[model samples]
Target: MPQKRRYKSRRTNYRRKSNKNNRTTIILIAIVAVFVVSFFGYRRYVQYQSESKVEMVQQDHSQFIKKVSPYAVELGRQYGVLPSITIAQAILESDWGTSSLASQYNNYFGIKGEDPSNTKVLQTKEYTNGQWITINGRFRVYSDFRESMKDHTKLLVDGTTWNSQQYRQVIQSKNYIDAAVALQTDGYATDPGYTNKIIRVIQKYNLKKYDEGIK
Candidate 1:
């Protein structure tokens, strides 16, 4: 009888040890799972923050366009032109009015000439002999920003190359992208990606809202 009692006690001890081992293994597995999930969650959160910072920088760039957009709209209304297109073109040409030429000469559009009778001489950088050569080139200088806008409208309307039906249709579409693309296709600019850049600036700044008030 004593041997049997001893045997029964030993079996109970063994069972308790086995259950404790199983519990320990389960706890360890749960801990590992939680760690993995937290690691991935942290990684995703960091990625989101990085993306948000990039978007904020882009928004800051767009703010400049927004500041000067109302002037473009008013000019368009008076000249019977597309407001969004004018604003996008101005943003593209002037670099949000931060360019040296724009700041000094009020030349939002880089219209150049050499004849004294038809041009205004300004100190500007000209690409000559594969170098950025500074010279006093004849550029169309405006008295103010409003005059620049008016001259841009007049240039578009009177210039035979830009006065085509196709160009007019695209501008009148009231779509900023369409107008920008048309400008590039119609030889309005020499840059290959000029239209895409203009479209990006317009869209990023939400400049299309100016078209809404058009009758």
Candidate 2:
């Protein structure tokens, strides 16, 4: 009877120890799982914040055309030009007014000049010998965006003495499409698809109503 009692006590002790170890292991496993879930959840929260900021910035840029269009329409009307084409050209040439030249000096149209006081030397692209080449050139600078818009409109209507012929067809065009084509045909830009780019900008912004005098 004494031996039987000792054996039973030993067996009970062993089972009790095993149960305690198993409970400790389960607790540790639960702690690790909670930690892993928390870490990933925080990472996802940070990623969402970053993405939201970028989306807001992009939305601001997309609204640039709407913000600057009133000035474009006014300048276009003053010069007897189509506002839609003028605004589209501004959007494409200036990259919605985010280009280095446009941002720095308000030179949105990339007009070249020799004036010492209002000129900036920059590398520009030129098509030569069936290929495009980069060359250092002087571009006109403006004090403000308004000045740049006025000058750009005037340039299209009344070009320089040496290049007035280039804008003759453009100034004479009665519609936006014809104006875009005339600008392209007269080498307004080096891009082969400059006319298409202008048209695309106009369509994307729904700018044709300006040509129809719609508010």
Candidate 3:
């Protein structure tokens, strides 16, 4: 009888240990599952935030284009310049009107000024002698973006002081490609890739549509 009772006690203890081990395994599995789910949830949230920011930036760019397109087209009609080129130049020079020079001084074209009162001295980057250089320059200030656009159109039409016909090729070119090339050949910007860059911008944004039916 004593031996049977001892055997029965041992059997009961073994079953208790087995039950405890099974419960511990289940808890561990639950913890691991929760961790995996939380990690993926966090990643999804981050991805969503990134996408939202990209969408906002795209919207801002579209709005900037809409605001400037009409004025650019009107000026192009009046001055015989390509509206597409003008808008592309503004997009590149002003960074969609977000640059400090554009936002503060309303200078979309980075035109220099001789008069101190009508200019703001700022640091600028220039490509010189096969390298980029930083230099301080007095940039022209304008009352508004309209004035800046008008001034830029006039500059292209009238040309610079040293050469009265500097941008003649640009104004006379029949297409945006030739115009872009002319801007580079005519020394509008010091960047070696200015022509290609302008062409790429025009193509990417379908700026040539603005030039439709305009001679």
Q: Count the backbone clashes (under 3 Å) in each candidate.
A: 0, 0, 0
Candidate 2 root-mean-square deviation in Å: 3.9
Comparing 2 and 3 by lDDT, which wins? 3
10 residues in a row with least lDDT, candidate 1: 160-169
Higher-lDDT candidate of 1 and 2: 2
Q: What lDDT score goes with residue 59 in model 1?
A: 83
Query: What are the models' TM-scores?
Result: 0.58, 0.75, 0.92
Query: How do these models rank on TM-score, best leading?
Result: 3, 2, 1
Model 2 spans > 4 angstroms off? 1-54
Best by lDDT: 3
lDDT value, candidate 1, whole model:
0.74
Superposed by TM-score, candidate 3 places the C-alpha of residue 159 at a distance from the truth, in angstroms, of 0.8
TM-score, cand. 2 vs. native: 0.75
| Candidate ordering by lDDT (highest first) | 3, 2, 1
Q: Which ten residues in a row have the lowest lDDT in candidate 2?
A: 206-215
Clashing pairs in 2: none
For candidate 1, write residues 1-215 as lDDT tens digits.
99999999999999999999999999999999999999999999999999999898778666856666777777767766777778877777887777766777777877665567656776765444556667676777766876777777766655544354535644455566667777877766666777888888667767778877663
